[model samples]
Every structure is written in structure tokens, then in C-alpha cells.
Target: MPVARGTKAQSTKQPRASKAPSVTENVPPQKDEGCQAKRSPSSPQGGPKKRSAFGDITNAHKNQAVTGKKEGVKAPTNKATRAPTAPTVAKNNEINLKKSLKKTPPAEVPVEHEKDSVPEEPVQQVPVVEDIDKEQLGDPYANAEYAKEIFDYMREREDKFLLPDYMEKQPDISRDMRAILVDWMVEVQENFELNHETLYLAVKLVDHYLVEVASMRDKLQLIGSTAVLIASKFEERCPPCVDDFLYICDDAYKREELIAMETSILRTLNFDINIPIPYRFLRRFAKCARASMETLTLARFLCEMTLQEYDYVRERPSKLAASSLLLALIMKNLGGWTPTLEYYSGYCAQDLHPLVKRLNFLLTYQPCDKLKAVRTKYSHRVFFEVAKMTPMDMMKLEEKLKS
Candidate 1:
């Protein structure tokens, strides 16, 4: 029976092979008939078995490879060529598939695998506190979210840039000379239409540089101009050129001299000139109090006056700013420093009293005739003439502080 079955299969395959050409010649030129004829020899019986879609696709690809043509093209009928070519084509297809898979991005991880891959960390809970910037959420430029943190960072930086009474170390230079230089820088700042920050930073640079380097009286103006040039570059969007600084000096110092002094100052301070100044703190603290523009300007005038005073040089910039705002509040009859100011400024009313008294004394008893630049600049109507406003009475200031 087995011999009979083998003979039947051979007989059926031989007849199909013999009829393949005759069928192709008689049939219409249709792709289906051509594919049916091509696949007939691979079957053992009179008809081909039904194939799955995947088997059809695989067979189509093999036909395409063996014939070196696209799908729907006639496949070769020779079994010798088809059998040898199919394996090589299939092996090549597998190699190409592997290469393509390597080039493709990895598929998404399964949820179970993903969960096991990385252990989740516990989320940290931050302590809740009063948010001063809650109302300023719409104003991106206010940086309201970071305002408190930024001021705290500035307070920490204050310790690094703190100054001492360095006047005793310099024999040729005096506090009067330093004050005169700062006063002149204020005028430069105004004449150039630079930001008030430029003036404050310039004063800071000069103080820090002077703390480390001894200067002669003649080179003082050079130092001052160079400091302004550096500060302008740091703070101004469009800083004055070297030639502008030279002209401002009435050509007292050459361009090379100013440039050299700038280099000297930078090197002496190790190029860390981001010194905190009272002006920054004053503006921030004023916001805490919700101060009027006029009151803020008054605080600003007081802070600017302190720039020319050697006595206040060692004071922390935040404390100086807080005290100036406090003094301005009392002078305006706006009451003493409130809890908001104390909270933000980090100084209660009592912590500010000593500096408040000194500031008041400086405002009331202005003696330097040569250092009138700050006073003159603020006396202009543009600044609301805050410099011309009367200093608060000492007794009333004291009483306010006590209360």
C-alpha cells in the first residue's frame, strides 16, 4: 500500500509538471492563473492545500526572491533553481530583518517589566509657608516664585563680600577721596542714562578693589572710571565704550591706563564682582511693604546717600536696605516697619534702629561740598526730588521705633 501511495504522488507531480507549460500557453495572461500554475508542482496531489495568509505572504516573498522580480511576476518553474535559491533568499531575508531590527528603536517596555525595572522613590514633601509672590503669578518678569529664595541667596552672599574699615590701611587715600569717587560715579551713571544698578555695582567694585589694593591720589580717578566701566559691562545692556569712559574723565587717564586699571581691579578681586548692594535690598523690601513709588524713591535716595559714607560700608546690604526703607517709612509718616517688611527683610524694627539713626544723621548733617553729585542727581524732579525732602525728626523716629 505504501509503495502504491508513493507511486500515486510521483505520477500526480509528473503530470502537473508536464501540463504546466501547456496550461500557461492555453490560459489567459492573468496573474492568478500564473501563480496557481507555479504553486501546483509544490503540492503532492491534484490540487494545492489551502494556505494561511502568512504562508501566502512568505511564499510570495520567496517567489519574488527566486525570480529577482516583484510580487505578481512569474516564478521560475525549475525545481533545481527554486530549491537552492529559496534557502539563500530566506537566509538573506533573515539577516536583513535582524539588521533592520537592530537599527529600529526599542519597543515600549511591558508594564510588568517596567514596574520591576526601577524602584519608585518616595516623593519629598516640602513645608508650606507664606508665598509673597502668590498675586504675581501672571507676571513672569517679577520672578515671584523665586523672589524669596533669591533674596535669601543674596543675604548669604553678603558675608563673602563684606567690607571692613580699610581706610587705615591706605596712607595716601582717605575716606573723603573714596566718597568723592563714588559721588562722581553717581553723576556718570546719570549722565550716561545707565541703570541705578550700574552706579551701585560700581561703588561696590571700587570698595572691594580698594580693600585689597593701595592706590595713589592721582590714580584714584582712573580706578573709579575703570570700576564704572566694569560695572557697566556687568549691569548695562549697552555699556559705554572705553573711549566714552576716557572722555568722561576729560582725558585725565589714557585709554590704556583705564583698561589696565580694569584688569588690575578684576584680578585683585579674583573676578568675583557680584557684590550685594543696599539698592537691591531696598527695592525688594519696599515691595514687601507695598510702598508707594514716592516712598520707594525716598528709600532709594537714602540708600544712594549711604554710598558716599565710609561709615556705612561695613553694614550688610540687606540691613542697610531695610534700615533705609524703615527710615523712609517714618519720614513719610507711613508708620514704622511692618511685619511684612520684617519677615522679608529679615530685620525687625529694633535691628534697624541704630542704622536708621545714623542714616538720619547723614541726611540731616550733610557736610561734604565736593561730594554733591548724589544729592544733585536726586534733587531733580525726575527723581521726585526725594533728596530735597526733610529728614524725619530724630525724636519721632525714635518714638516710632520704640512703638
Candidate 2:
């Protein structure tokens, strides 16, 4: 051993050959034997961990016990100790948060139900009467072999012709203005002897046109007369000439104006005029009710009156026609919507109750001083003077319905 002048002498003793580590050795340095993990008999030095036949749980217990007894042994001091249960508690909290999210209810979505998904909120329907016999209902149809099939075909397709929210969209023109137009068109239809389909389709075309274009209130009549001309061409084998429409409008509109308005309507509607109407439903329901020509005329009179109603335009045509026929039945002292009517009309009396009240009001409604054409026209003889029959204690009837 050498000693430097300013430094202390080095120790003469060297590490023993068996205790010193070689330069390339991988084995860990020696530790207290009593605190080390117990070695298994089959495990060679520096090999894989020895595990119990059952599981690692036995080794975990042994490690815990040995670590508890080795408090004197130094472990790394850098780690911060946490509560023994902190990890498990944090995991439980995370699980609870996930469960709360899963249990939270979501908003309801709208879906169309097959079995008449229409709202129960007083749909334009008629009232159900007490029990009555079906045998007493006289069958007036020439043939009703497949009337139900025809009703279903049209009813299924009625949704296509649904007009936009015109009352909301056409804010410039009031509903009263529309009422005046319809009242005047009724006279025109009667004067020209147009088919009832022509009138219904004409009204529908005018609504669709008004929905697409933002016309001033003054142009509303021109729109209506133009729609009538268009519908006549569609429904009549020989449609009225443009000049005839001018005569109906009292030449308030020139032929060129009518023609231009017709082009605008066809463009607005995309020329798609094969729309369903209340008249078709009326015919089908009349045949199903086995109604007399007088009864059909009365129902037609009631249905025609509704065209003047702005709110009623939103109603399904089938519903409107059913309401009218049901009212006519009660007025005529016939049963209140027998099952045969239900089977053919595809509507129960309850389905018509809301609409029935509306029609009753319309029937009993007195037009404003300026509007008397509907009242005056239906009061005539050819229409069976149904406008006069509208006063029959529409409120009172011996309503007897059969199951």
C-alpha cells in the first residue's frame, strides 16, 4: 500500500476472491439473506420467478409478510406513498360515473306508428252514437264488392298532396281573402258546370301556387281563376277557354294575364297536378253509405262549403269528406256511421267527431255581408236546397249505432 503526502494511507486489505464481482457479471449485489424472497428447489440461479401451483396469490402473501418484517431494509425513498385504498376507490368512482352516464335518459324521437299514428287530440272526427242494428241500414249501392279497396288506395296516397303551411307562409293575404275567393269560385264552377273534381283540384293548385310565390293580396283572385283554368284542362274533356275564365272574373283579368298566371302556377307546382281531393272521397263514401242522390247532394253541399274554410284546408280530404257524409247521415235520420261506413270509409265515428263539429259550424255558419254566393247558390232548387236543410236541429237526432 502507498501513502501520499497530503492524503491518508489506503487500506492494505482487498476484497476476497469469492465475494468480489467480475467485470461482466449480471447477478445483483448481495443483500440480507433473511429478507430475500424464498427460492424454490427446482429454480436455478438467475432464472424465471418461482410460482405456487395454485396461483401467484400464495407468493403475494409471502412477499407481504417478508416485506413487513424487513422494515430495517432500505427501499427507494423517491416514491410518494398514497392511501392503501386510494386506487381501488378511484376505480370505483370512475365506474360509478360511467353508470350514471349510462342510466341518464335521452330525448324522445318522433316515429310514425302504423296503427293510425295521428294524434288523439280531437282530430276532425264525428261522434259515436249508441248501439243500432246494421240490418236496418238500407243498402243503396248498385255494387260494393270492393269499395274498401278503393278507399284504401286513395287514403294511402293522400299525404302526397299535403300543402305547405300556406296560412303561415302567405302572411300578406288573410284567411278572409281566401274565403272570398273560394266563395266566388263556387259561383264560377256552378256557372260553367265544371266537375266537382275540377273545383277541388283547382283549390289545391291555388294553395300550392300561393305557397311557392310571394304574391300581393290583389293577385290572389288572378291566382284562383288561373288555378280553375288549369284544373279544368286537367279534369274536363273540354276545358273552358281562357276567355271563358276572363268572363268568370268579369274581365277584371285579361286573357294574357290569366295565361301568364297559369304559367306561373304550373312552374310553382312543377306541373304536378294529379292530386287527390275531397270529391273523390265523397263519391267513395257516398257509395259505401248507400246514400240516395239527395243524401249525396247534401254531403256534396257540406263538403263544398268547407273549401271556403282556410283551417279546413290542412285537414285530410278523406277526413273532410267523411265528416260531411256523417253529418248528412245524422241530418237524414240515418245511423251515425255504421261499421259498413267504417269498413268502407276506413274511419270510425270517433274519428269524425272533431271534424263533424267543424262541419256543423260551417253548415250553421252565416257568411259575412259581402260573401253570400255559397249561401245563395246552395239555396237554389237544383242543389236540393240543402243550404236551407242545414238548419234542421242539426244538434238533435235519434242516434243509434250498432257494434
Top-TM-score candidate index? 1
Candidate 2, residue 16: Cα displacement in angstroms equals 99
* Model 1 Cα lDDT, one tens digit per residue, 76-127: 3443232222233335445433443343224212433454444643323322
On a 0 to 1 TM-score scale, where does candidate 1 land against the true structure?
0.67
C-alpha lDDT of residue 315 in model 1: 89
Query: Who wins the lDDT comparison?
Result: 1
Clashes of each: 0, 11
Residue-pair clashes, model 2: 11
Per-model TM values vs. the true structure: 0.67, 0.61
